[model samples]
Target chain A: MIENKTNKPQRDGFWEKLSKLNRRYIYMSVGICVIVPLLIRMRLPIFITPPTKSLYNVVDKIPPEDPENMLIISFDYDPSVMPELQPMGVALLKHCFAKKIRVACMSLTVMGIGLAEMATEKAKEEFPDVKYGEDYLIFAWVPGWSIVILKMGENIKETFMADYAGKSLDEFPIVDKIHNYEQVPALVCLTGSSTYLSWITYANTRYNETICTGITGVIAPEIYPWLQSGQISGMLGGIKGAAEYEILLKKNKLSKVEGTASVAMDPQSITHLLIMLFIVLANISYFVIRRKK
Target chain B: MSTNIWVWIAALLTLSVYSFLYKDNPIYRFAEYLFIGTSVGYSIGFLYWNAFIPRIVRPVQAGDYIVLIPTFIGLLFFARFTRKWTWLVRYPIAISLGIGAGISIPLTIQAGIFRQLQATMVGDFTISNIIMVVGVICTLFYFFFSLEQKGVVGGVAKTGIWYIMIAFGAIFGYTVMARIALFVSRVQFLLHDWLGIIK
Candidate 1:
């Protein structure tokens, strides 16, 4: 050799190999971890976190007053995040319907309209007596994001003169008593993006509207500061939040059917454990390789 | 198994996307392009009906010619296509930016700064609150470049690094959960909705 390194003999091929493992193998392992528990019908215990409970309690406590008891649910996500968000949307709708609380659904993103319709339809299947014009309505998505929120604060009917079907909102009794954030008890936003901040900024800060969020896991940690500040009344974070809400609904007899979030929890838990194990293994391999060098 | 034709198409597309895990292939590319194309098409259609017609066409048809003002301003955005007329695009851009700033500035400061500061400072003296206050202060110290980071300042900055790292770790964990949840949903569709193998 031209010049042998000081510790050339100390190199371990095993650590080096482990450190250099193919990403495809890890992906396959994750796939297995996700698919296996789902196939085997494994059930994992889902602990209800405080934030989820707070969300449930907030919705539960809304007085079932006529049209004033109405809740505005802003669907701010698309099909891409429907996996984590749609279940919570359905669960919330079911809860609202079960309690006889009216809902006015709208979308900030155009793509959220389909998701909103899907969720409403799914919840409608369970609550057959729920009427559209009387018990709920779907407002067509307008272009502006923050401007829409600010406009709704002034007059909801003026902002959205018609529903999604092009029917005048004045024809619907649901919008008769509900005009702005003043009449509604709370505004629940289901989102996978930072649009919840718009609700906090315009809806809560300006109009004093109570804002609650059901958000994707990626934005969960981001909401804690606002949650602590009482800017957001409650939150359901990630799929686990959905599962917890489902459990709460089941316990309260608001939902009889098993929700998708509840069913997915088994796979979710197992996948999380598997990922944590991989993280540990990768760190161990790196440390071992470094020491050997 | 789902007898619906649409469900079958969706399931096949989902599989096409998953096929990328093995290696990049034409099937994956096809599915990717299809998704992008469909989304863009849907958006354009939605905007035309929901925004263009309702906001501009309907009002103008009803004799409210005032709506044409904003419509004309919006059309100016197309001026960027011409070399000589490109400067006209800035008028609408400036107006929108001015209005956006007017709306966002006060609300942002209230929601993002004042409320957060109040919460951090005026919270009850619990152990968690104490830790949070300290963390906030130290993190602010880390960002204060005016002071030379040496001795006590350096030590506090290092502590701030620990908090920052811990926050990053938590976010990473949640991101992983989110991605896995998406995968689990697809698998659920394949098993329960498509194949009817699970309920």
Candidate 2:
């Protein structure tokens, strides 16, 4: 019989006091830790992961001034996840525009269309050289999830009759040179849910399109197997992925690049260290109290 | 964009949501209700313009009568609320389920199972790859519930439990990062966007 060893420390006076301590105090400290780093513009050392670098390489390798090497960036998140995900979407568009990679943009989710527009607004403002309809096109969210995915391989224009603003696809100069998943080199989805999985299942399998995903931290681990399988070109797992990309772009001397993700990193590192500190202190207190008992 | 009232509204709404961390108050409840109401309102409007208008109306305006097939099938969904017509709802539900299951099965097998197995089998001989290969096999062995645990198989299965625990620990660490990120973002908003403390 397998003996399951349980090592739970006895809760005594010390544990009770720590537990009863004002919750507001904890919240206040967390707030201070995040804010102090931001005000000073504190820079944190970022170790870019292999996956993040692979994503960077894939984006960097998109041949400049070539409309045929088209990229599709789909925004599939909402305001709730805007802070973590919006930076990723904005940074990716910045990279594409900076490299002059002709791209098409869409959203799988209804909530995502507004967020997609926000990302574009930020990116386009920073890089004024990027013109609408010629350089990039924005598509509206359509119902029928897999139906739309399947339609992309056939007639992408027919999939959605017009842009998000109700302008026909023919009006877009970018679509003149690029149509369907076949013409596109890479399809990137910055999503908060399993929307990336659908892209992998449909787009990658059927049309043999090279896909890259930028997902939230929660779903990032599940995507590792796919990354290892080489079904995905690259992955940006959460804002860490975004921060890594920002560091790479900054290293390349891309001026006026938004460092939002990198800025978030200082707070991220500090907060993580703070959390570990709390856990260690708690454990130490627990063990010391148990010994006294 | 100087002194945008909408920004102030957003900041207030954000604070109201954060207020729940303190205690449930009328302010939090009001904001929560308002958020849900606004989201539903916006989604309805967006679906009308983006999906309903473009996909259905435009195709009909262009004399594509074949599009009515899917439209009629969709209307069957509304029949669910009526007592007499409740039976009619099952047709759409059945159709959707049938279609969804049909689409998902082959793709799930190809991407989720077959490719996963293939990747594990043909991985290059690296430290990480070797660990992954062993971990995968052991983990698979742990799920063999039919046979009683005995000798080497039992030991391998036991090792699989450790790998599973380690994987879970990694996921938990990532989950911590994600939660911290959410809190940090709200603070970022309050500091950088609202107060303009950080530039």
Candidate 3:
């Protein structure tokens, strides 16, 4: 006892002590920090940079009703990713509907059906006069994602026998003209995984279909090669990309629901910054302890 | 307060969930448990509505005995909870795997393997495309089984690593930008949406 047994638990220095706090404590503080700012309606002025500008231009250039024009929306994500993707899906659907483009929706993942339905429902709510059969059709989820693309290019009708609502695809006026993949002007993949690469291989390879992607931030890096090599025309990755797409749709005066993604952006930014700071501090502490050793 | 009060309460509970990051305190623990319970409850409800009621019970009630095939398979999933009956789960797994593989591989061949090859072969011949092609070739060749690395082929393979590194760097840079975008979004939320200080 007199010797101060165990050397007082080897008291860590300032930086070391800071690093030793339970990770959950830091996580909780971060949660509060992010939530408080979001609730207060704090937002930064977003500059319309080149990437966002390009995204806007692409959507703008497409005439909403060009008959030869076909837009494919691939729903490859589930409800877990809805908080980030739903807004983007809604915005994209709104833009296509406003333009009067024929919309063909397909799902690779089973959960994607819900997301696809939500998009169509939102579109119908805003564009009330829009007829389902005449304007759009929802393809039921298929098991094989890449094969579905190939089959779509080869024989679109054989691929999707009925719409999600059980309506025959042949009865859908909008989809009546889309017998194959070559008719599609663009393919948009919304996924939380690297299935974008498969789109490249299938659509771009067999059908020569132009592809774009809206994927989660976690899976963004893996798809850059396609983006760089011109296999993909554009990409909207993660929450930030969603916000950017919202700005584009909002600016066009298409839909007011654009605020959903933009509102969430602030909290996302703050949390990221905090995480980066923590990482830097952790690294500095690691180096300091190592040098002392 | 009326029936709509539940919405506000739910919102408050959702926020409380976020509060757990500060510490593993009671509020966070409570929220965590609530989320688990609610999620399980919702899933069970969904299963009953979407799976059991529509697929099994309704079919049985309607005197469609054919539904029993799927009904039996569905019940087999519960075998996962029993150590003795665990092998029964594999029957479903095998069927699912077979479907998954049959669905994915041929299509993957058409997409991931064959389609990628076709793209590379017929790609644009511009300077950027050419560089990309070279990188792709070198990268592909780097994994060549017959080509040993001791000679010029080895040198090219080593150079392939450089190309790969560059590709990786570009991806990394894009990732950084994406992360930065997330950060910017969250910051804007705090400043503009939450505090009304910025817009």
Candidate 4:
């Protein structure tokens, strides 16, 4: 046959084969690598960075006031980034509710309303007594991004007349008492976009509200200088950031707080290591081919 | 392993999208189309329910005079569909751009430039602080393209390149982590929520 006559493995065939590897095989390997580690529990050492610790300290040390008006945690990202940012919402809610700190949760982005609702609902399951519109409230999404934040500094109820479910703010005795950013002690903005800038511009600078941010990993480094300068009070960079927060709570001998962020870290760490190994292998093959040529 | 129909749908759609890692085919195209269609449809429904219903519909019903101005301006967006009245859309666009520009200039100068410059000056006197100060100066000089590369400027510009490359590498590394985090999230959903293989 023509294959038998012409086809023979060359002396340098190994590197050439590696260099010409099909993309599908690599994809499959990564998929398998992620799924296998995910099927079991692996406790990865999550180093708690100072920025993340600062956020925890801020959230933790907030005075548990009567009627529980302490923080406004803004859920500003949709489901597309729920994987990275939602964990922070869940952890923050658990931390607040457990400490008996009242929070008024809202979202600036329309798509983030569902995520905000989901995170709040999930956290409340742990502590059944944390009633909606009492200990915690979901304001949901308003139309204006920067305008909403600006108007919120003036009057929150005027900006959002009601909560997510068409209920009058008048009915909720807890939320009715809360108005404007001046009343708010701390604000945590979790976002997948540039909505954080609006919060900083209007909410922080104008009203002088204490603001922390939990942003996606891609935007983390860009905002690092902000954290160092104390422009923002605290920060959670990504899922790993969320995991670090979860760890901080668990270490304090608090209630069970292990959730998606901690569970997902194992696969994340393994996949990252696998990627590095592949990069090395790829470069080796590239160099081998170039030197031979 | 999962009884929920929603989980099954999510799993299948995720697989279809991941199929793009191989050569593009009908499955990937279907997934892509589905995602776009779903996003647009969801946005319309969400904005209406969460925004327009409460902010406009309820307010105008109660005879709030202030609500009418924004409502009229919003209607200008639909003018793009009409040939003769397309130019009318410019009024709303101009108002928005003017407002946005007016707001952005001061805020950007305050937060983006002023606060950053303020941060650089007032850091603790450490080795990292020294590096940061040097890095910022060199990086700023590197962007000065008006002046040709001469001896001292060239040396400073070269140092600036190094800082710029390091920052870019940090960004690239974070970008990789972001992408991997996204993909891994989908896989986690498949395993934990969809398949119920792990909890």
The docking quality of candidate 4, as DockQ, is 0.66
- Choose the strongest candidate by lDDT: 1
lDDT of 2 by residue, A1-293 (tens): 11123645644465557745688877777877887888876686889899988988887887876866688898888787777788888888888888888877888888988888888888888788899887777886888888788799888888876888888888877777666887788888988899988998888987888899998888888888999999988998888888888888777766466567888888888878887887887787677555554
Top-scoring candidate (DockQ): 1
What's the iRMSD of model 1? 0.8
Query: On residues A143-186, what C-alpha lDDT tens digit does candidate 4 reach at each position?
Result: 76788888888888878778888787788877666778767878
What stretches of model 1 exceed 4 Å from their correct place?
A1-12
Worst 10 residues of 2 chain A by lDDT: A1-10
Query: TM-score of B chain for each model?
Result: 0.98, 0.92, 0.71, 0.92
Off by over 4 Å in 4: A1-12
Model 1's lDDT to the true fold? 0.91
List the per-model TM-score of the A chain: 0.95, 0.91, 0.90, 0.92
List ranges where model 3 is wrong by over 4 Å: A1-11, A47-63, A66-68, A123-126, B1-199
Off by over 4 Å in 2: A1-16, A285-293
Better TM-score candidate (1, 3)? 1
True contacts kept of each: 0.86, 0.70, 0.21, 0.67
Model 3, range A1-293, lDDT digits (tens) per residue?
Answer: 11234555455678777768688777566656666766675677554544445555665566576656678888888766665566667777788888787777888876677689888897678888777777777886554566687788887877867676655677766766677876787788888877787787767755688888887766776666566556777877777777888887777788765456777766666666776788789999888777755
Candidate 1: tens digits of C-alpha lDDT, residues A1-293:
11125634543366577777889999988889878988897677888998898888888888774867678888999899999999999999999999988888999999988888999999999999999999889998898899999999899999999999788988999788777888887889999999999999999999989999999999999999999999998999999999999999999899899899999999889888888888888899888766654
Mark the 10 consecutive residues where model 1 chain B has the least summed lDDT.
Answer: B117-126
> Which pairs of residues have clashing backbones in candidate 2?
none
Q: List the candidates' TM-scores in order.
A: 0.97, 0.94, 0.69, 0.94
